[model samples]
Target: MPNSPLHDWDLAPREAIALQKRLAGQVEREDRLDPVGRIAGVDIGFEQDGAITRAAVVVLAWPPGAEGEFEPTTLEIVEQVVHREPTRMPYVPGLLSFREVPAALAAFERLEVRPELVMVDGQGIAHPRRIGVASHLGLWLDLPTIGVAKSRLCGRHREPGPARGDWTPLVDGPDDEVIGAVLRSRVKVKPIFVSPGHRLTLPTALDWVIRCLGRTKLPEPTRLADRLASRRGR
Candidate 1:
């Protein structure tokens, strides 16, 4: 069966903020995942210069090792889905999920195989309301998800060591609470932000993303999805 609506999508910024706060408390921060055999990557974008919201989801086999900057030889893609719809709402600074997640959920609903874990190209608990695109999608799908974002949406962090796996904690608030980690997926390329979206801890999120890295700055699953969604460079 297709996924039902998690909440009303047609929302004002204020309503979205309140909904984010309500959903944020529902996100599980502990490792409570089944044995992960398949992983999915999500990429959200726009088409026709913002008239359409496009979402891509790519499912790949798991256990691809964290090798150096070389494409994985055994990376296997099992499924992929793309969903596009009219842009729902204007972009709001702290309410990105409200603008992006509806299409993502549609893409996931169209997927043939349900991935055990998901990696999203956006923030997770690192958002101001602790509910970025990844976290919001996770709540809707009830799946374990990790935010493998190219940039940090919130929190401050020291520079991670310029190596394949070195990472630094990304902290927020007065207490300096650790929300995520900044990771260098490649030796010299830009680092990525890794945060647990749902049903996983921050450390577990980092481990899953590291496990999927292959050659590029973005991991295999996400890289493919981004390329698919953007219809551009790999």
Candidate 2:
């Protein structure tokens, strides 16, 4: 397991916002990722009446297949790990990492096979502060990561076409800066928000995410993680 203390997780809202501003600069929107083979998807779910935070990490070996033809049968699952800890922070709308990341770090600590890249189930730079959970965890783990959010947090974008490869730029309305991409991973299914977390560019993030797609709306790694996080609580 890899570990690095990037910052203190215990803080008030003001302090968390300040830390986000400082770390937002460290996020590299340009491509800095190595040749990826293993990819991990992470998700945090609450249990014990929202008092326990359960973080699940699912690692999958990237399959060699043609673009837009990702079949689940071809991919291999390398590892699946979960860690649980009592929730420390309240559910704040914008400061989600503060509430979710502590448990995620614990889950990462249990990982035996370090993934080359990680896919977090949250936003990256596509936030009001541009420091969502994906970016936050990436800075701590110092690994290439992507934000594979199921819904939009901030930014505006046209509805992507109902096709697997169709996408549109997710832009900040005020500055008109492109922050991420709204990608249609499965035909006629709701698109997922794809953003560069750390050590990755938006284009590369979308490419990898599209490659990881199977016969589901969410990618295989995050989808499996989501299932594990949900099912483990019961």
Candidate 3:
């Protein structure tokens, strides 16, 4: 599914903002996926004092017998890919995609199985400019993707109930636009922000993320990816 070229990562702050604005227009806020049998979680870890970036993608299989069932279950890791590369872009607020996505894309290229959907560990349309890492990479890969972020980059929302599957609409405070969701993945744990990255509606994104969650606060795919990325660079 590697269909198109992503924009250049190296750029000035002004140029990056411009790029985000241009790319944000292409993000699709509709459900555009067929039956998804596999999903991937993507994350990046830095080493060597941010000199080396290690990116990991872990794919999980969803057997056909049950879809949409959110019971606690173990999903098999069908494929995993990790790529280490020199860090090219410096950290910038709201432009974290440019800092990490190149390495993540390299790892994505090495994946033996292309996932039907990807869950990225960052924001999506929830950003100020509405082009977070998940949206950025999803557009480049041209696949259905969701953003499952631990913290907020933009928007405000009411705290969801302290129970699994609880969620509330995340709205842009200033514009009062519904952008994403605040989802409680586990009881008593901090909720994660869920947003549509590309080729998915906000509801669909939240649905898939909840389905992927087991006992952990984060979804299995993303939790595994986080572990993989965290351990690889150490």
In TM-score terms, candidate 3 sits at 0.92
Residue-wise C-alpha lDDT for candidate 3, range 127-226, written one tens digit per residue: 9999899999999899998998999888878999887898999999667999899998988888999999999999899888888887788987788899
**What clash pairs does model 3 have?**
none
Give the C-alpha lDDT of model 2.
Answer: 0.86
| Model 1 deviation from native, Cα RMSD in Å | 3.0
Candidates 1 and 3: which is better by lDDT? 3
Give Cα-based local distance difference scores for all models.
0.85, 0.86, 0.87
User: For each candidate, what TM-score against the reference?
Assistant: 0.92, 0.92, 0.92
**Best-to-worst lDDT order:** 3, 2, 1
Give candidates' CA RMSD values in order.
Answer: 3.0, 3.2, 3.5
* TM value for model 1: 0.92
Tens-digit per-residue lDDT, 77-192, candidate 2: 78888888778889888899998888888888898888889999999999898989999999989999899999999999999998787999999967798989999888878899
Best by lDDT: 3
Model 1 regions lying over 4 Å from their true place = 1-7, 64-71
